[model samples]
Target chain A: MNQRLKLFWAGVRAEFPLLIGVFPFGLIYGALALSSGLSATAAQMMSSIVFAGSSQFVTAQLVHGAAPGLVIVLTIAVVNLRHMLYSASVAPYVRNLSMRWKALLSYFLTDEAYAATIIHYEEEELTPASHWFFLGAGLSLWFTWQVSTAFGIFLGTSIPESWPLDFALPLTFIAMVVPVLKDRPVIAAALSAGLVALLAFSLPYKLGLILAALTGIIVGMLLEGKESPKEAL
Target chain B: MNIWLVMLLGGLITFGMRLSFIYLLGRFEVPETMRRALRFVPPAVLSAIVFPEVLMPSGKFDFGLDNHRFLAGIVAVLAAWWTKNTLLTILAGMAALLILQLVL
Candidate 1:
């Protein structure tokens, strides 16, 4: 077939593995959100409206605790701050696309979509068809998320608590990150970020994640700066 | 402070963050240092998320033998490092957690 279709399918294939992990998580979110006193309509709409998995889960938990709306909204923004880093990481690759394409892809910029798309983008130089791959990955995930949410809403209380489905999310991340840890800076970044996350995890509103990520990025950059001159010499 | 209002505002804020750099970087040039740092974003951010989720599964730090997730996470790490395969790594971790839970 054509290049666009080929690249699109490649993107979908790359994202397929993550969808398996995301589906169960979405199911749990839907069930939890409904049980957390949100109306069924609101719970279902949240899968589309907020669309960020972790934040949606947090919102559900907060709703259960009868948190004020202002607190939930603020929590969402704080939790999703990491998406800014993702936006920066991906911006250069999609810069040449139109505003319309950028807007559409931005809606699909959840963590899983970004994970798959960034890995693909890093493998090659950008081409006219590159955004098509991102669209493919993002779109497939969007579809999976909505469908899984509906299933969760339908079968609200039946999901077994015994399944360790949530563990799949971290395992998927490990699989992604370990393959890319090829150098001292990258390894240091991963280790330092992991350590800092454990240390600062009690920070409210999930700020610890953003702080840990920034610390790791700075660590990686500093190490790279020092190593660059040695390699140049 | 309606729930609908919360969702609307939250959605808009999330959309804005997702759109921020994708829109700005096209218009303005990023510095060389910032560009280099972006390469580390994935490893750093993903590790940050993963470490907390696996280590602090219940919002409290758990490092004892009772923490099956931590043990399973180490298994998954080895699986990911050795195989670099996503599906395999997830399977190994899930299996480890389930088995550990059942036995211990």
Candidate 2:
């Protein structure tokens, strides 16, 4: 076998552990997206279109709640803002690739892909086959995400609508966000956003969510920036 | 406000973010403040959604024990905080919700 293919398969094998985690989320995302009032086509298309796991889930929840298009798009951007860092980190190694390769690789750069690629890059950073390794890691994840989403959608269609499955959406979000709320600013941010969301619930076109999210971000940022001596203690 | 349009725009923006630094490549450095702000986006955004759903289930404040989702959400929070397990936290929250809704 060729060295690039050998490296690519090694990258794919490395992704197996991470795949165990993402596969279920993809399934639940498909199930939730459907219950959130999206058509089957839209639900499946989203697996490819947005391609970011958390942001796709958030988009489904917002769409289910009848949020306007603009707000949903804005939320997607915010949730995915972290990807910029990944792009920067991976750029130098793949800098010699063509524009087409850059664009394709950028689209494939999910959390799992970046995780696998970065570790490989640290060791084999400038190897000619490094991009192939990235492609292997990314393509494996993309395949799994799509297949799992389709399976979830199939299962979603059979479940009765009266079962209150939609509750899973927020429940899933709680599970994800709660684990990350250890820091003081993050805790404050969560509290502030939750409160603001309630207060601004009646705002037109669901603009309140955007308002609440912004307020939380700004508050968290300000608190972090103005760390007092007492906080240091 | 079409769903397809929203997705198209969202996808493009996501692609842009993922491509931004890579394309710019040593030309512009991300500011320290911006980096710090990015860390808060997930908790802030997710909380904004989770809070309204649980606390305002009917689009009005409901703080009583009868509010199953609110109670269940708290359970999930504890499960997540303690275990840091995604599947376990979800199962705990769902179980709590099911039991609460039936009892209340």
Candidate 3:
């Protein structure tokens, strides 16, 4: 295989585990969107148009409750603020790519794709073919999301409530994050973020997630800053 | 306000945020502190999501023994820590949650 294809498949392989988790998530989103009074076409289109998991779910709920258009739009913006952090995190590695490539990859920048691609980049850094891996991961996730959402729309509320399939997402995240906690600062960041998420769980529009992430990052940075002075003792 | 219009606006905003840094960083330098903080983004953000999902399965905190998701999450954490494998961790977590739900 050529280098690009090889890298692409490598990305697909790395992202396979997360796809298993996201597939069920997309299905639930589709089912929920329909039940929330969205038309079949609108619910399916949201998967492609909005292309976000959590925010799409929130939008469906608000629509069900008859929220105004401006309010839904505002809520979506808040819910998706985390993507900016994701954009920044992956920016340096893809800076050399063309504007078209950047736009394409940015469109694919879901949590699963970011996790898979970042781990690959941290290990392998930038290569001529690294962007292909990002493309592969992103495309595969996009395909899975669209298909699963369609299935969900077809089989609304039929999926058993007892299955606990959504737990796979958190498990996937735990797998991704735990391996990265290589130092005290990183550990502190994860713990702080987790604690804050719980404490701020009631926040509207999922703002707690952004707040918790910022708190964790600050805690990590502060501890790392103190590390040099502490080592001199 | 049509639903399609709402979706279009929301989608544009989302795509803009996703593109913002990637597009700007190519034309300008990212600050040193921002570069360093980026390293923590994965752990911090992923934990922020994972913690809430497991701890508040029903959108409320439940740390008691009967909170099977919390217990299952602990098992998944241990599995991930030990194996460092994504698939195994998910399988272990699902299994733990199933067994707990069945038993309790």
Q: lDDT per residue, candidate 1, A146-167, as tens digits?
A: 9999988888867676676556
lDDT rank order = 3, 1, 2
| DockQ of candidate 1 (2 decimals) | 0.57
Query: A1-233, model 2: which lDDT tens digit per residue?
Result: 49889888988998888787777778888888988889989999999999998889889878877887888898888778778878877888888888898999999998779989999999864777778889899999999999989988989878776666667778778877887787888889888988999999899866777788889988888787677524321
DockQ of each: 0.57, 0.64, 0.54
State the number of backbone clashes in model 1: 0
Minimal lDDT window, size 10, model 2 chain A: A224-233
Judged by TM-score, which candidate is best?
2
Instruction: Return the TM-scores of chain A for each candidate in numbered order.
Output: 0.72, 0.83, 0.72
lDDT string for model 3 (A1-233, tens) is 49999999999999999898788778767887887889999999999889988778768867986877987897777667768878888998998898899999999998789989999999996888899999999999999999999998999868665576556667767877898888998999999999998999787756777799889989988888899644421
Comparing 2 and 3 on TM-score, the stronger one:
2
lDDT of each residue in B1-104, candidate 2, tens digit only: 99999999999999999988778776777666666777787788888888989998998999988788889989988988897767777788888888887777
The best candidate by DockQ is 2
